[model samples]
Target: MTSPRRFDDRTDAGERLGEALRDRDVDADIVLAIPRGGLPVGRAVADALGVPLDIVVASKIGAPGNPEYAIGAVAADGAVWRNERAFERGGVDEEYFQREREREAEKARQKAERYRSGRSEPDLSGKTVAVVDDGIATGSTVRACLAMLAATDAERIVLAVPVGPPETIAELREAVDDVVCLRTPSSFGGVGRFYDRFDQVSDADAMSYLKTDP
Candidate 1:
């Protein structure tokens, strides 16, 4: 039989995750969560650490007919990172990839503005910012977020997540100051499969998390 699924909810899991980070001595100036699902976890981290919580909106450009398979991801300001293997696997050519990227870039830009909603992004200059996410599966979106963070002059950029497979975590480590991942289960299938209630996080929900200042 399969082992019992872990975590009760995002908050409970996040609190446990926050405690783990504290134990590991992972501290930061602020906790920036990739919007929607990440917001709930980021809220717990920020609250546990007594820091502000913010959202960094990013979008994944997935291969057609395989929405879960990310070929690339786009963040605000038009930065993107493509997975060559994904392109090859998806049978996407350079011309098609470029065209798709431009389309997704615009979507990312629009999504970012919607998430920001006139809220000013905190200046990362001289600040140690912690980038939090609910989890990582493909790492494409996380890479995009890291790319955006890199553009800022943050003194330190930390990637924190409740869970991720080992391979993806390893690939992501090179992009940030430090990665604080709590769980890397061998049976990792997807982020949603690990969550008890992995519902779709709407833009309104994302904005609510930001508006709550959690």
Candidate 2:
């Protein structure tokens, strides 16, 4: 049997998340969504908050033989978030981790450039930026993205998501200025479990959301 869902879809979740942010009185200067699932959610959030939407790219560095298991993540700007426990469990060495980080960082950079389509990188200096994603699982990529943002001159960085596990959300709280997660289920199996319509978002469709006027 399928699990009960809290959201009809990504857009629905995003709308609800936006409302939550408004209730918190978060005055964000921009919304940066993690593609490709984050764009739809970010679109709704940007529209609701009357701000411009953009993309922040990150790629997961998986375990050596298990590509599905993320041992770490790297951002477009080369900032990295290493899962030390995963590394120890997987027996991943510095050489392998460094190699994967470099490779994945390049891929992330290319993806960001493609999504931007010649637009220069936004100046986040002294701005209140909200980072949105569909949800958080292990939060590897989100951590890497947050690490990148932390290195910037931005005054505040907020992480907004539709849902996440209680433990993950608690840990993420320390990484950002504020968090605006709508749901933090203790029995979470996965991010898709809380969504009735969790579909894979294509690059083209995701990019279209960025073009939407907020």
Candidate 3:
């Protein structure tokens, strides 16, 4: 088995990703992170690129009995990405999916509202946007986010992550204009395994990063 490259933490991973984006000359107008884990990484990327920091909220639609197994995901604006194969494999019907989609979409909307704290949503009309995430696991959430972005008038959309499995990254490529993944190891496990300090970030701590004062 191949050894996975480890990052000191989300901040370290973000720095590496930011450097990669800069090296590739990725010009972005705004950095929308998927919190609460993505905030630290987003802060680093936004600072490096001199862009405003924001968030793109989404929620997973887990399997009927197994909440951890994501069958799909829903975004704040009701955009969705359904894993047809997983849904078929889990024998999930359209009725159940519709119910969960509405529930999860509302949750995503509320989360986005809370994160924005009364700020108006950014106008992505004819601008390049980067959606930042700590890493990709199943990619259900990120896929949903990309779908939401697709509905906007944004000129381009980029999905940026520190690490993700090669296959999943390949699948994601079809959903966005560009993908900036720092590492795609062959012998992939969970995202936490590649990080030395993968602690659960608190909402308060995550919100602090959104502040402009530093």
Candidate 4:
């Protein structure tokens, strides 16, 4: 029997993921990381690929009475990705979903503005863009972010992550041109379980990764 694989930290996972992308010949024009946890990973990946790093923000719309359970997600620009099955299971009504969507969209917009710090959104037109994240669990936010990217004029979109559950990864593949995930565990529990140091990242620390020298 083999022991399950683990990553030392987000940076470690990013380095490995970067190498994997290189090995697969993934040529990205820019790297867009989902903050606040994806910044460190995206910084490492951007450094590895010698490309600029940016952010794509999204907020999950949690189900009623289950704040941690996401029924959908909304992006900074108001793009949304809904999980119909989760909505049905959670007994989410259109009115509740619409209300949560507006609330979360504002949250995502504010977060994106804070992270950008006055910089204009990058022009992904005719560019190959890679979307990075620390890892994925339910992937609600990632889906919302991807939906926003798909609305852009990007020539190609790639999703890069360190680890995720097999089913989520498979579902995500249809949302992007390419998916470069380092590990897809069959019996995955959560993203944190695969990391040795899965500490929550603060906005300050996360934003620092966007610095040229950070």
Candidate 5:
């Protein structure tokens, strides 16, 4: 067996993810990618599956003082996923959680508007959907997005990522109908660590991916 390792870039990871999905005969009516990073991967996957690509927006609700530390995440439609353990550990109270959830949820809505550029969101009712991202760490954002999707009438919700820690992948499995993960390295550091050129994906670049077919 080939040893697990890093990818050349998000595109490479996307291709591998697409191939994995195909190998498993995953079906999807549409592909919804987490913006800014997931678009590249989503593009490849959507193209491979012969489906239209769309964006699913969510924002991390950081802890009270440490903005980079996520205590939870909220999707555009106000659906949320909170880490109860993290909240207790971080000493996050309900008031603060509610405040952050409201703020982040608004941000997610604005982000979705910006990405769509006034286009209506694709109807997901009764359709099989694949949610793609470059990778995951705590998976707070993906969890929030999946929670939101779960409330919808979609027939299936599949979470696809190129790499993540073993534990993170396991936790995510419970939140979706299926998960297609290419690599789950034990020595997982972060998503960028599994890519050779894991740079910040610019909004313009991400938007371009959405505009292009496949």
Candidate 6:
């Protein structure tokens, strides 16, 4: 078993986690990171593992009045993570959900274009893929990503993150072949709370990481 992760920055966290994963397994073809914040961490992982890295862009559909409240989230290719509990709690109808999905789907497409335009998505058929992220919060977005990757004919999929809530990590275990999170705190409030310098990753920084030869 690997030791718990503690780092000064995302690059440090990614390098440490990547080394752990590389020491355990050596058959990953592509390390796909969920853009904006995930890119830098992914770059470090890709560099350490000597693997190709790419983006898996997705966006969440927040409720109208409660913008932070997620009803559903969609990937670039329309894979949806419907929160049934949120529907029950928020009292959202199908029409509202559908409309929000459409809006978020468009945003996802635009973001995908910004992240990876002109470049075709990497072919995952019969290849192992490591999905990297800075961290996971409620896990809605990662679930959407797992669903999207499930449509492809990949040999295996690994979901790797720096940290997440214990319940979210448990929920993710059933979604991917392996879950590689170093920290699953019981009192996890948010991803940013764990990092020392967790700043909002800008589009330029994100795109730069994507373009880097990691």
lDDT, each prediction = 0.81, 0.92, 0.90, 0.92, 0.90, 0.85
Query: The CA-based lDDT of model 6 is what?
Result: 0.85
Error of 6 at 24 (Å): 2.1
Stretches of candidate 1 exceeding 4 Å from the true structure: 1-5, 88-90
Indicate the TM-score of model 2: 0.96
lDDT of 1 by residue, 1-214 (tens): 1224576667766787778778878778888988878888888888888888887767788777777778888886667888888766657767876777788778877877787787777888989998988889888888988998899889999898888998888889899888888788877888877778878878787667777673
lDDT of 5 by residue, 96-189 (tens): 9898899999999999999998899889999999999999999999999998999999999999999889899999999899988988888887
Error of 2 at 26 (Å): 0.3
lDDT of 4 by residue, 121-153 (tens): 999999999999999999999999999999999
State each candidate's clash count.
0, 0, 0, 0, 0, 0
Instruction: For residues 1-214, write the lDDT of model 2, one tens digit per residue.
Output: 1123489999998888888889899999999999999999999999899999998999999999988889999999999999989866757889999999999999999999999999998999999999999999999999999999999999999999998988999999999999988888878899999888999999999999988753
TM-scores, in order shown?
0.91, 0.96, 0.95, 0.96, 0.96, 0.95
TM-score of 3: 0.95
User: How many clashes in candidate 3?
Assistant: 0
Pick the winner on lDDT between candidates 4 and 6.
4
TM-score of 5: 0.96
Model 2 bad stretches (over 4 Å): 1-5
TM-score of predicted model 1?
0.91
* Pairs that collide, model 4: none
